[model samples]
Target chain A: MTGALAAAAGGGCHIFSGCGFPAPGLQDFIWTPFFTIGQFQFTKPMLLAILSALVVIGFFWAAFRKPKLIPGRTQSLGEMAILAVRDQILRPSLGRKGDSYLPFLVSLFFFIYIMNVMELIPVFQFPVTSRIGFVWPMVFTVYFLYLYLGFMHQGAWGYLRNMIPAGVPWPIYIILVPVELLRFFIFQPFTLGVRLFGNMFAGHLLLTIFTLATWYLLSLSVGLLYAVGSFALAIFVFVLETLVTLLQAFIFTTLTATYIASSVEPAH
Target chain B: MSVRDRSGRDTSVEAESRALGLNIGWTVFSYLLSGMAAYGLIGWLIGRAVRVEILFPVGMLVGLAISLGFVIWRFGKRGITREETSR
Candidate 1:
């Protein structure tokens, strides 16, 4: 009887065989282009990034194409959200003179938000941001902008001075200088990239595992508990992942604004 | 010190002191909690997936290392002054 029950429980394992682990060898998690004429061999992540960009542009274009006098539903909703980020997050952090950087902040916010939301889509289940290649480009973009703006506003020396906090003792400068340098040049972009990458990577992995577990456990009589547990965890994680998708985008945009603001303001 | 100068300095000093405390506390707390939660979750999941104890801590360390790298980089650069320096 015990053996029979175990056999019945193990029956469901066949349903989850293919979906358990990531793909094997070079093809694992990577989508290679079928046709490559020259040196340009497009990968899955790159294609997804491009798609994300187009979707962002398309959404805004459609919503703002025809402006109403009083403002229509979609246009008004979109415009209001954009304006809120501008006024509440960017403006306050950046101050009055920082208005010029609004376009970049807006674009970054929507671009990231759209890419994040891609994970929830039916066919495009994988988020492009989960891949390091896609994340590196975005991180570098922010890094270059911050460096450029800092130099433009304060010049080289001024930008350096902006980094060191005032009122430290002379002897402490030795330790503080190197720490500051490491933070600005190396740490900022690294963290920004890792934060997004880590969150999305972990979230997707959890979803995959739970999904497979759910299927595997449903195969036998004694497996009902496992199936139920897996299902519950999967649903819980899905909701959290959705919230994280939005939160990450917000955090990235806010940090960009803060970085820009720091560049423009005089040292205290 | 004179009374007026002492009072003015005291107010500004108190404000700066408060801000510094708040910033430090907030940063430490936020990173610590998030780090713990992330590592715990990853460790649990990996243990379940592979059915191995080694992978649990290994996964936790990997996650921790990544998060630490980020926090250090983001906050470390704030102290540098980027203005032109005389040769």
Candidate 2:
């Protein structure tokens, strides 16, 4: 029995023939560095980020460059969405003072939405936001704006006091002060980065897993069942990812307005 | 000039002007400084957690939440109606 099994194993019956699946390994899982210029090296994620930005810019440019008075279908839809962000999210949360911050907020909202939507594109089927390098710059931009606004409005002492708030009992100051400090210094930025990262990362991973599963099962005896299941899951996640892409973008922009509003409020 | 009018007008105008300046200044300053710090911290954390520096995008989200909470807490407390009215 052992000899027979050994002979059969050596008979060249590959377990995963014609599966069209990239083998699981570092080469398959790791993204390659595209090239290096001077000290800087560009990778897949970096390329994706650039592509995502260009796609977003191009799409909006085309959509709004030639505005129609009566409105074409695409332009009308685009205009309505931008108007919604301005009216519903920005104005209400930031108030009249929010007008100045509108451009920044709008850019952030659309850029993020496009980057997230990259997961659905055929050849560019990767969400650039899933990469941390791209996210840090964007996150930091907002973080810096917040800090600048806070200090600019209030002097050092005023800013510190502004943080502590008023009306808490004297005893509670001890508890609240540290908590507030932590929230400002640590929590805010962390949440912004993680929330977007987690969602995109999970979405991309799910899509990849289903796609690979579909391929793998298609090579087996009961492959049809796995393929169908994988296809269904992939489609479901694709739709979900689309919603998440937009929702995350909206959340990020809304929070930015809220932060700006908080810093700009008059100090008692 | 009447003492009441002179003192009330001068003090209210001064306070309002100061408040406006402070609001604009603090808003910009806090956003920039905290934004940079948060960005750096999130990048560091993501590199540490995921063993990948490119994972910084994931960290941005974490940083955003933390920083926003801080900014709100720090600034929100300053909105004391009593203090403003008293001034």
Candidate 3:
């Protein structure tokens, strides 16, 4: 999508020109594989996902490589980032007792945040999460962890029993039980992935549309005015995407912690 | 046990409430979705068997009502308990 839009803009696909508007669509998300190994096709989003992981690891390693009584600038930044996730996201759900899960949550938060932030960076304008494939594994891991923890702590039968709200009449349980089961086993994990994917996908598509429109509207005539408006809107959408990226990551990590907390402690 | 601002006012309560709000919002949405989907599918299956097409939409309405009733009972119970505690 990025390269295609750039080409169209450079090629002068203006409104005055007979050439139709090169509207961005799902094709924008479909990239030619950089290389192929057997049936596996390596693409830009895959590279971005790997690079996101490395960026997270490399930053933390540089920050905390040498233990220091007095922290350096990098360490301070590292501490600030981790503490933000811990204080704002993890603790609100899990409290002090769940401190052991801090490293996992921190990694998840930064990995997701950086992957999303990639959409804003030059030459890597695609959000990896917009590809639902990347999101599901993360969602499934959290789902598995919480379910495993639930069974481990509460016993399998007890865990199932705990999911049902107590004091509800026996007959109502027929309906209520299925609803609760669907909510926990299916809907929770499904929504977790869908929420992140939908936000990134829609945000990227919107930015693409406005940006392509800006280029397509550019002309010597009154079309230039519309082009300028489109350009401004493109900039606005770009700025909004930055906040959306972070907010989505926060929501994902917080929900992960919430699920874990629920598993460790039964529903009230 | 609670977080505090620079002025030393505890902010954990506010944070917890915000978290609760987020969870509740999602919970409500999921309940509505699950109810409609579950009952709607059942209705579709039964309607297909009986050759009555109206049951699909009817099923969805029934599901929505059941979910709404359950949610009200569930949270309304908590609300009543809180009121009693304050008294």
Maximum-DockQ candidate: 3
What residue runs in model 1 are displaced by over 4 Å at the alpha carbon? A1-28, B1-87
lDDT string for model 2 (B1-87, tens) is 111132122223433333344433434344444544555565877698878876576545544555465455544645423233211
- Off by more than 4 A, model 3: A1-10, B1-11, B80-87
- For model 2, residues A1-268, the per-residue Cα lDDT tens digits are 1222222324433225632443332233246567889988777667777776787677678779999889887788778777766765566455455677877877788888888888899877778888766777888998889778877877656776776556556775663454456556665666777778888887877777676565555644766787889889988988898899987787777667666665666455
Q: For model 2, give the interface RMSD.
A: 12.3
Candidate 1 residue-wise lDDT at A158: 86
Candidate order by TM-score, decreasing, is 3, 1, 2
DockQ of each: 0.04, 0.04, 0.29
Worst 10 residues of 3 chain B by lDDT: B78-87
Of the candidates shown, which would achieve the greatest TM-score relative to the real structure? Answer: 3
**Which portion of correct inter-chain contacts appears in model 2?**
0.01
TM per candidate comes to 0.70, 0.66, 0.92
